[model samples]
Each structure stands twice: as structure tokens, then as C-alpha cells.
Target: MTEPMFWMSVAGVVLAYAGYPAYLVLRRSLDPWPVVPRAWTPPVDVLLVVHNAGDALEAKVANLQRLDYPAQRLTVHVVCDGCTDATAAVARRLASGRVRATVFAERRGKSACIGDLLPTLTGDVVLFVDVRQTLAPHALRALTAALADPSVGAASGELVIRDPTGFAAGVDAYWRYEKAIRRLESATGSMVGATGALYAARRQLIGPVPPGLILDDMWIPLSVADAGYRIVAVDDAIAVDHAPPDPAAEERRKRRTLSGNYQLLHRLPRLALPGAHPLSLRLWGHKWSRLLVPWLLATALASSALLAAAGSRLYLTLFLLQAGAYALAILGRRSAWLAGRFPPARVAAAFLSLNASAALALGDYLRNPRAHLWQTTRYQESGR
Candidate 1:
């Protein structure tokens, strides 16, 4: 029983990180389901929900105005969510024939703002974007092109974070790894979640997002999948955002995102049930299993430690490896020397940080119901 428990614990951790991606690779190679994107430019509603992003709006709006799509077919809607800053004024000042602005007096979360604004958008496709990131000139066109495939109901653009250093480098490494997984997931079938920084969905396929939802990106894509549509990844559609300047800022952002994973399941329990969701298995393997990894790590450590105490050489070696990795992670957190010198250490440290955040996420969610009202993480604006 003890040996079985130890093996199971190790297997769970391995399967979540290594095994799942391997399965995805094999699945794509054997019975591949590819997205057939074509040249299609439907009417697009470019939506921006800003809180206190007034300083960035001018550049963002200018960037939108430069998109390689038909000006007549593209409209930009900027919703100001109770901005105490100059956000409302800037938005109103930017209003033009193709750009419109709306202001809400109350400080509703982004999800709530999106919900209120979604119904009013009348376009073939709605592209959701953040103010901080600058999209490629052809981003909207690339995103809409994926919607040319009948099975694809939503398309998520890739986010490129530039010039990362220190622990930000580790976070950046993790982001690249995550993007590869999403790309694979898209090629095989649907993405478990979409990139919130830049993603577009068919207007008819999406419904109003629930208020106070932290992960509207996840909710939106999963909802489209529930309606029997594929959520694709558009590699050519890029939104460039700079890496957070501070390691703590990156950790906070990660914690909030991890917390949202819990909130997602609570809000949409049907997604976990096989009978209710078509992509339940994928969701479990990709998202839910990851949530359990911290606990699995804890279990593996405890079980192996116990077995090692009983003089088992195999368990002792496993325990040493785990301990050394964590020690390196701790060292990596304090100083960037090891990770800067060793790329693998950078990723490992980042992976450990993520799992730690996932473990803490539940506490954050339970203690603060208003955790959805996010404080924006600071990052420099990236060009092109």
C-alpha cells in the first residue's frame, strides 16, 4: 500500500506536466484535427474594457486605427469602468466615426463591464483586447481569418512578452511553454482557455459573461466549446506586452490567474462533468489536473520521505531529487545567479512558483470574494 501510494503520487505529478503534453503530441500526430483558416474578413467589433488605463489608451487606440482591416467594417468600443483617472475623458476624446466610448459610474469588475457591453456589440466577430498590449497591424485580420473555418467559434492570439530579466525571465519561459501547449491543444481540437490579452469570438456564439468572474478568458472559450465550436489558436495574430519589471508583480499576477482557475470550476461545475461538457476530459487534464499538482507534490514529498526513512534506496534517491529541485527553486527566488546561468533552472523555478501560487489560490479566493476586482500588474508597453 505504501509503495503504491508513493508511485501514484509521483505518477500524478509526472502526468500533469510531462504525460499530458506527450499525449497531446501523439494525439495531434495520429488523429489530427487541424483548423482550416482562410482569408475571411467579417465585420469586427474591437472591444476594450479599461479601468485606469487612460495613459495607454491613446497609443492603444492609435494602434487599433492602424489595423490592416477595412475601416468601415471595424469599430472600436471603449468601456470605462468607474475610472477615477482621466480614462473616461481620454476615451471620449478618442471617439470618432469608427471609435465609440461608454462610461459606467460604478466600479464593476471587468467581467461585469464586458457582460453589460457584449449585448450591444453588433458585429460578425468581437475582438477583446487589453490596453497595455499593442497588436500587430494584421492581428485582427489574422484572428478573423481563423473564423473562416466553420468549426472554429473563437480564435486566441499569441502574446509576446519582451525583454525579461531576473525571475521575469523564468515567468517568460513558462509563458512560451504554455503557448506551445495551447497551440498543440488547438491543433488537436479546442483550447481549454483563450489568451485574455487578445482573442476574438464569433458574436453569435458568445453569451454575456457572468459578473465577478476572474477568468472571463477561460469562461468565454469554454462556453463556445460547450456550444459545439472549436476554439483555435492564431499564431500570426500577436499582441505584444512587456514582462513585469518586478518578480513580486509576476507572482501576484500568477496568483490571481491561478485563483481564477478555482473560481471557474465553482461557477461552471458542468465543465467538469463528462455528460455536460464535450471537452471535459481535456479540461481535466489541462487545467484541473494542474490545480492539484501542488498537493500532489506535497504528497510525493511526504510519501517518499517516509519510505526513505525505512531505508529504501529508490525512495531516498527520489526524495533527494525533489529536495534538491526545491532548494534550487528557493535559491533561484532569492538570487538569479543559478537560473540566469542555467536555462532549465529558470523554468524549474518558474514551475515551482506556479504550483505554489496554485496552492495559495484557494485561500485567496475564499478569503476575498471581491478578488475578481483585479489590480493591474505593471508592464512596459511593447512595440509591434
Candidate 2:
């Protein structure tokens, strides 16, 4: 029983991390669905969502104004979601013919805020963005061009992290791996999700996201897929962001993101079943499988330990390798120097940290699905 459990767990881990991506690569090679992006300019609404981003609003608005797309075609909407700081005032001060500013008096989660603003959006394509990341001048152009393809419902921009070190370096590596998967998925079919920092969707396909929901990026793209359109990856569309200053900040971000995955699963149960969602297999491989990886790792480790106790040489070797990897992860966490010097250690630590975040996010999802609704108000005040 233990042997079967050990092998099953190992297979699951491989299937989640390696096997799925390999399948995508082969699929893309066999039957590639290419997006035909051209120099097409449509009216675009740049939706800049913020929560207590007073200091950053002005610069962000300036960044939007500087985009390579025609100023006349691009209209910037800065929505401040129940900001307690001078974010509202800054947005108002920056308001111009091209830049529109709206503020919510009460704190609402990002998804609710975006959903409420959907009806008011004025553009052929709605570009969603966060305050912190700056778009490359051509990013908007690239996304809009992809939208020019009638079959493509949405276009996701690639996120580029600048000057990462420590665990952030590992995060950067992971992001690259993730983007590769998205590219392959786009080539074969619609990707399961979009990069939340920067993505564009056709207004016609855009629908209201559930209130108090997290992972609007995933929801919007998947919803578009449900409407029989593809979400294409625009590698040229680049959104630039900085790594979190510290591990704690990264952890918080990861926890919130992983919890959003759970929220997505709960809201869209059809995605998990065969013949329900068009991209069900892709979602299972890319999104759902990773959610179970943490437990799979534990099962593999525990079973390996039990087999090793029974004097099995193969299981003993496997157990020692797993234990060594985790020990290195601990060392990487305790010593930033080691992680910085050794790339594998950094990756190991980041992998462990992410799995831990997944476990914690499960708790968060179970404890209070709406815990994030007022989270912005509380945490922003606390300087998170």
C-alpha cells in the first residue's frame, strides 16, 4: 500500500509540474493555433485600479499617458477603491480630458470594484492594470493588436521583473516558466488565465465578475473562453514590476494569489469536470493540479520515509534526496547569502515557500471566503 501511495504521489507531482507543460509543448507543435496580430488601433479604456496608492497614482497616470498608443484612442480611468489615503485626491488632481478618476467611499475588494465599473467603461477594449506596474510604451499596442484577431477574446501581457535578488530571483525564474506554459497554451488553445498586472479584453465579451471574488484575471479570461473565444499571449506586451522588497511581502502576495485559485475553483465548479469547460483539461493540468501539489509532496515524503524504515534501498535514497532538498530550502531561508550564491538553493526555498502559501491559502479560503473584501482597508492602514 505504501509503495503504491509513494509512486502515485510521485506521478502526481511530475504530472503537475513537468508532464502538463510537456503535453502543451507537443500539442502546440502538432496543431498550433496562431493569433494574427496586426497594426490595429481601437478605442481603449485603461482601467487603473488602486487601493491607497496615493504616492504612485500620479506617476502611473503619467506612464499611461506616455504609452505609444494614440492619445486620442486611449482613455485612462483611475478607480480608487475606498481609499483612506490621499489616493482619491491625487487621482482627482490628475484628472484631465483623457484621464478620468473615480473613487469609492467604502472599501470593496478589487473584483467588486472592477465589476461595478464595468458598465461605465468606455472603449472597444478594456485594459486592466494594477498601480505598481508600468507598461512598456508598446505594451498596449501589442495587446490591442492581438485583440484584432477575431477569435482572440483577450490578450495577456508578459510581466517583467526588474533586478531581482534572493527569493525574488526564484520568483522570476518561476514566472518565466509560467509564461512559457502560457505561450504553449495560447498556441494550442486559450490559456487558463491572464496576467493580472496587464491584460486586455474586448468590451463585448467582458462580463461582471462575482462580487468579493479574487482572481478576476482568471475569471475574466475563463469567462471569455466560455463564450467561445481564445485568450492569446502577447509576448511583446510587457508590464514592468519590481520584486517585493522582502520575503514577507512576497509571502503575503503569494498567499493572496493562491487563495484566489481556490476562490476560482469554488465559483466555477464546471471548470473541474469534463465536457463542461472547453479548456477543462488545460485548467486541470495548469491550475488545479498545482493546488494539490503541496499535499502530494507530503504524501510522497511520508511514504518514502515509511518505505525507508522497512529497509528499502530505493526508497531510502529517494527519502534522503527529498530530505536534503528540504534541508537546503531551510538553509536558503535562514541565510540570504547562500540563496543568492546558489541558484538551486534559492529555487528550492521559493518552491517550499510557495507550497506553504498554498496550504495557508486553503485555510484562508475555508475560514472566510470574503475575508479579502475589507482586507485592503485594514492592511493598507497597517502599512502592508
Candidate 3:
């Protein structure tokens, strides 16, 4: 084959294997699993790990207190690791008798704090939550009910981005697509991964997370799946939260996530095991492929540009289209005129943004594979 044809063929193969597989996995919502009767009154322990959380602590505690589940059956554990602010005091004052506070004067990582609290958990089910998010009133019940399935090792709630405006609007749109894909993957079998904002699993199925682990959420569910348990996502169980409004703040978050992806790729063997479930395969394709997408995209762009210089109009046209799409996406951020007029172009821009973020993340990963700890960015929530 000619050089231009060869490059196009390579791009086609990569898109088919990586991109098309994701499309198929995310094409449809999973059929609803039979609603299992709540036969067992298992004690539930909700673990909220906070670090220098500001005024949000009170709101989070209040939301938990208002859960529809019986208060007597639910216990909340707030782990304040290395919290310098009034986080511990706030937890103690607000929760009072309703919540238990585990304060570590020294700053161990979040995973280590979880490790310290793991042995102390006496509940049948352990639910993990972040400080900034709140679950729906019936979220606990729905998650617990889903976990009643013998094959399900863990269950995560649907994550809804509460506000979508400005830069966060794009992020919100992306999350909706992500939720749809997870729903489809779950229907086909097990979802690839759960959002850390809210998810629950049998206490016995959780293994001790490594102290250095940055993405405890990913590791916990993967561990459950490795032990032959299915990690399921329940649509009825919903958690609402917002993404960071600032693009730089969002970039920091993605960098940490990508770093964790690298760690998981190196550490998690169950993902590559032969005879792994279809769900596991789907998860592998969905998550890891995205991590490597930026690299692939870079190669495609460079090769296409080179082929275009060598007099291939097809390659040149595709390259120009890609560039124009990104320009329109930037324009979309400025005003509705561009966005409304070019919906397809905006979508392409969104995809390009995702690939760009992934590329930056891969660069960070390459520079320092050992870097794990990260300071959570403080960003304003857009009202839009």
C-alpha cells in the first residue's frame, strides 16, 4: 500500500479496535436487573474521608442525616486525615451523636486513613462518599438492594452533575455521556468502574487499599471483581455533585486521575487475566483505551499532516476539519451563536478536548510515575 493509504489504514484499525468498541459498549442502557427483595437488614457504614473540607461538611452531614434509610441501621464514619482546618471540629459538632469521627493528627494519605478505619468497621456493607457530594434520599436503599444479588460484589450510584454552565457545562455534558455508557456497560454485565463520589460494597469483599494508592475507589471495586464478584451500577441510586469550574482546576483533577490510571494499569492483573468476564473486558477497553487515546491521536495527526504535505488531499482535508472543529469548540465556549450553529462541530471539539486532556495526562504520567499525592483544587461552582 502507498504511504498515505498505510497511515489511513493504521488509523482506521486503531479507531475500530479502540473507539468502535467503546461505542458498542455504550450504545444502550442495560436491562433492569430483577428488583431483589430486601430480606436482610444489614448494618450499613458510610465512610466519608475529608481533608480540609470547608463549609460543605455541614451540608454533607445534614444530607446523610436526612437519608430515607432508618437512622438506627446506618452509621457514618468521617475520617479527617491531616485536616488542618476546622474539619474535625465541624464533623464532631454537626454530627454529634449521629456520626463517628476518626481524626489523625498526622497527615496520612486518604487510603491510609481508610486502612486505619477498615478494621473498625463492624457493618455488613461499607459505602464510600466524598465530602462535596450528596446522595439521593433513596440512594442507600437502592444500592443495598442491588448488592443483594449474590453475584454482585459491589454497587455504585448514578452520578449526576448538578450544575452545567460555562466550562463546567461542557464537563457536565461529557459526564452525561459517561453515565449513559456506564448504564449500557452495566446492562451488558458489570460496569467498568464506579464513580468514587458514592458507591457501596460488602465489607468482606473489600481488601485493604495500599497506602500510596491515589484512586481507592477504582481499586476497591476492581478487587471485588477480581474475587469473582460483579461490580454493578444502579441507576436508581443517584449522587449529585459539580465539577470544578476552572479549566486549570479540571486539568489538575484529570492529571491525578491519569496518574492513577497508570498505577492501575501497572498493578491490576485481573484486568488482563484470561477468561475474565465480558464486563471486565468492557471495562478494560473503556478505561485504559481512553488513557492511551491521546497518544494515538497525536500519531494520527502527525502522520496525516506529513501525508498531506506529500500531496494527499484526503489527509489534508481531514486534518483541516479536525483543526476547524477545535476552533469552533473554543468559539462555543465564548457564545451560543457558534455552539447553536455548529452542534456537530461542538461535539467534535468536545472529543478533541477529551483527547487533549488525555495527552497531557499521559505526559504527566511519563514524567513522574511515582507521583500520587495531590492537593484538591478550590474552584468556584458556576451557577449556570
Error of 1 at 33 (Å): 1.7
Alpha carbon lDDT of each predicted model: 0.88, 0.87, 0.73
Candidate 1: the clashing residue pairs are none
Scored against the true structure, residue 169 in model 3 reaches a CA lDDT of 66
Tell me each candidate's RMSD, in Å, in order: 1.7, 2.3, 3.5
lDDT of 2 at 121: 78
Native-referenced Cα lDDT, model 2: 0.87
If both were scored by lDDT, which would come out higher, candidate 2 or candidate 3? 2
Per-model TM-score versus the true fold: 0.96, 0.96, 0.87
Order by TM-score, highest first:
1, 2, 3
The TM-score obtained by model 3 is 0.87
Q: Quick one: ranking by lDDT, best first?
A: 1, 2, 3
Best by lDDT: 1
Q: Write the per-residue lDDT of candidate 1 for residues 132-193, one digit (tens) a residue.
A: 89889999989988999999999999999877877778999888888989999999998988
- Candidate 2 residue lDDT tens string, 1-384: 999999999999999999999998888888989999889999999888788878777878888899998899999988888888898999999999999998899887888888888898778999999777878999999999899998999999999988888878887888889999999999987898999889999998976676787788899998899899999999999988877666677877888888988887787788899889888988899988999999999999999999999999999999999999999997886677988899999899889988989889999889877755634321222221
What is the clash count of model 1? Answer: 0
Q: How does candidate 2 fare on TM-score?
A: 0.96
Error of 3 at 173 (Å): 2.2
